[model samples]
Target: MINITFKVTVGLLATFGCYILFQNKLIANNVFAGQTEEINQNNNEVSEQTNGESEIDVVNFNRPISPNPVHVPGWYFVPGFITQPMKEYNVHLKNDFQITAKVGLNNTASSGFGGNYFSWFVSSDGVNWDKVSQNKHSRDTIDTSVLTDSSDTEGVRYYQAYSEVQPQVFNKPIYSEIATVHFIKGDVNATEIKVNTSKDYLVSNPNFDQYISASAITQPKGATGRVIWSSSDTNLATVDPYTGKITANPNRKTGTVKINAEIINPRYMRNSNVFGYKELQVKKMLEIDGETNFQNTVLFRLNPDFDLSKSKIEWFQKLDNQVHKFTNISDQIISKEIKLQDNNSEIYAVITPLDIDDKPLPNNATESNHVKIQVKDMPPGANRNVHIRQSLSNISIYGNSENIGVHQLLKHKITFNDDSETYGYNDDNVDGNLRIPISINETNIKIESIPSGYVPDYRIENDGLHQDIIFENFPIKRHFGFDLIVSTRVDKIIDSSFDYNPVYKYRTLFNTDETVIGKPVHAEFSTNTIEINPKDINFGEHSKLEKDDVNREQDLDNEKFVDIRDKRIKYSPISLFVSSSGFQRKGAPVRNVPITLANYDENGIEISPKGNYFEVASSMNNSPLKSVFWNRKQGLKLKFNKLNFPDGDYHTTLYWTLEDSINSQTK
Candidate 1:
């Protein structure tokens, strides 16, 4: 009873709540409520049926259109049929959608609308369509256009097929990016210029006019060229512009002249090349008054006759200040005389070529030739006075002989020849201070000069000046003489004093007594006699002994004295001999024999007879006596403890006087 009453508001609210619940369930289950499974199945079957029918319908439609109809999009066009031959047709999809088109007549259909060939076209907007044909058309048959469709759900863009008969349809407008380039310029200016001479130039006469040719100017890039030449301040040199030649004046003085080369180039400015200056040495032929006689007056002349047109002569004198001053003389070919102030002085002349400015030309100027003079003196007198003197020519007797016994005296005197009446008295001065004593028997003294080759006019006198020159007791014999070759004139005078006889004395006495019997006795004696003469003596008068005359004599004397002493003997042997005879008698008949004899016997001994037997006789005889004498004397005895004697001859004379007194008286 309580549930039967209901409100309209509550009912509505309940209905709304149920609707919200059902929407939520539907959202959660992800399902659709309006369409059932059966309905979906039925719809799918219908779709299959419709597809089958559509496919069939399409097949039928394609068959009726042409036997090989190419299906394209839903809207396609075919060209009108003509008598042209049929060409093949190809269809391609656009945006993955199938599209086909054909224009060929089919025998089965017997009704084709267009020509035999067909082309396809595609466009996403459907306005600008591109043909897609298989023919030789510009457009490609394969789809290349990008298609967009409103019904396509996928966000994919792709190319559609397009073909055209003309190649212009594929080419389109194209633009390249913009770019820029730059460049710079380099320098091309010229720098230097050079110039030179062409050939050798002669500066002499007769082609002395030869000129030095100028060479062409060589300039660097971008420059104009010109040349100008100027010589040194003196106008001796000049150059011609047209011929490019440098010429020298023949009359120009000899010296170095500078030549300037001016280069006229616009780019190089006023540049100049200064060539080495040419040297012009002057030359000329000139002669002085012969070189043989450099003294006295001198003359100067020009060779080849010194023509006035060729050369001129100039005179110059050198002063103490070393300056050459000009003289007042004008001559070229003519000879001019010059006087020298002093005999030992020198004079000179200068020659110059006759040309403009009196300049010295090449091979023309001659240096001044010098000359010197000499002087002589006076003569001597005719008659002259002279005197002669005696000097030791030599003392050679002792020089050659060493034995004192052979030493001889030698003397030499020198004389002079006297000229003119101024002669004085000649005297013999002994020059005793210079004299030498000798031990010789004889000596020849002479007065002579030293040497020959002198003029002779006077004589020499050999007075007592060369006195008794003697040499004694010399051991060896030698010859001695003086050199009479007078060094000057001498007067010949001879004088001499000599002792040629060397005397020796000797004496001896003998006493003898003898005993014993008769036997014939004999005594023998011998003696030594030394004979020395003037010929054995030498006085050392030879030239070789003149150096030591005094010493020569002394030495010889000492040697001779030693030899004499050695020859003297003392108590030499005196031979004595005695003889005796003895006899005995037999005693008769036993009778006693008595014999008596004297005890001492002086001379001959006697025998006496007595008694009965014949007396025995005995006699004693005295020996003869002999004494040895040296020369004429008994044995000479010289006693000396010690003596030093040289080897030489000692000349000594000995006389032996023998006295023998022996008497015998027998009774």
Candidate 2:
């Protein structure tokens, strides 16, 4: 009975197994046939579409796979096991003629499933498709250059990312929504490199378009190309490497320079070169008063034809066969008045052109014309007044109208009507009034005395220092002569050795809002020397160190003065600092020492016994500072700190620093 039962069970089991195998085989065949039919249908449509149109070369891509479907347990088919479809993707054409497809994967758990392969395909006609040959995997991106040859065609091409998985059960491949990219015919070669500039020359210093540009022939008619700009002479001009713009050098001379613009990749064209020059020319001629005699004035003017926006103008007076150059002359105005000197004099002008940076042009340049004038001595005269010894005449000339630090005194003496022929005059006149032309820098003149029965009239011309004093025509004159003194004051100190000594004599009118005398106000140490020598301190071996005063005064002649100090700070006092290198016993280090200053005053005065010593500066661990007023009389009294001393003749070096600055003064 048991044997019979076993044979029956085996037969039934074999029948059941055969039924399951047959069903799986039928399902697999159906899935394969469905895929084959779809592929064949697409190929037939592509063939029909290409009958009259251009044919695209398609590359076949295939991946090896087992023919039989793998078996999976029913538990493996979880609720979310289905592969999710891609949401979004795009195709791009790179500069290197490669096509890149970017795909966005679905953020689902099934994204990590096996056989999550994506097969990318492209088609000129929407019906025809060919798989891309590169990186056909489960990645989110695929790049191929196969379609680059067709990128020149004028039409739309379609692409699709077909997703498939090696599933245990037979199923159709999942297809994503189609994406498209449009390619229009393009002419990529650049044919010409044309260089263009707004202007050929640089006038003065302009911040406009002082550069050159370049364009080339492309598919789009007005497309720009990558160009490199260069200059033939860097000293004369320079060009920006990437901007293709040109600029004149700051110290460029009056000459021409060549500018070149070349295409970075000159496939179908050549480069371009242009000639540029500086817009420099003396448009107006120098004019001056031709002739003048003693007590007369000469006028010099420059026409506003030349561009002075970046140039400097200088006036010169040639007197007594010596050329004297005028300093601090107006750079904004074109006219000037000169006073006649007491000698044969000639007045002229010098114009210097500047580059964009306001630096002088390389070549030495000047523009001017000379005017002749005569200055005569006094003629023999008996009625002339010589009793009035030097009368004081005060006048405000160039410089701040406000109170300045100090004014320099300029004095001049003049004797008139001594001799008519001395000034190139042949006729001797009895009733002649002498006219005295004053210099731009001369503010006032003093007269010794007026002739009897003769009154003097002072006349000013054009709101300037130019003036004429008319004396009553000498009555019963026998070559009358008079003594005259001229003097002026300047805020800045004048040094006799300066090449432009006359510059300090005149005030600056360049900027009316900031008019200054010769130089601005400033203060500094009395001398550049930093070492200070103090009186030796003597103490008995048994006596402890005691503080003492070292009376010291800065030499006014070498102290803070105008034109010699920094002129940046307007209203501020200078700072005085004192430091020491400790005390040395017998020229060897003994102990740390400190000192102090007291009774500081601008005027050098000895402090009274009852007077308190000022704690202005001290040489303690810290270097103490003190304020030094500019207007106050400055003096110093040094004090030493009390300390036990090793009595082998202690010595120390002191450093005194007077700094003129806003920060130092505030500290």
Candidate 1 versus the native: TM-score? 0.15
- Compare the candidates by TM-score and give the number of the best one: 2
The RMSD (Cα, Å) of candidate 2 is 34.7
Off by over 4 Å in 2: 1-226, 231-240, 247-253, 258-450, 453-480, 484-667
- Looking at candidate 1, what is the lDDT of residue 405? 22
Clashes in each model (backbone N, CA, C under 3 Å)? Answer: 107, 22
lDDT of 2 at 332: 31
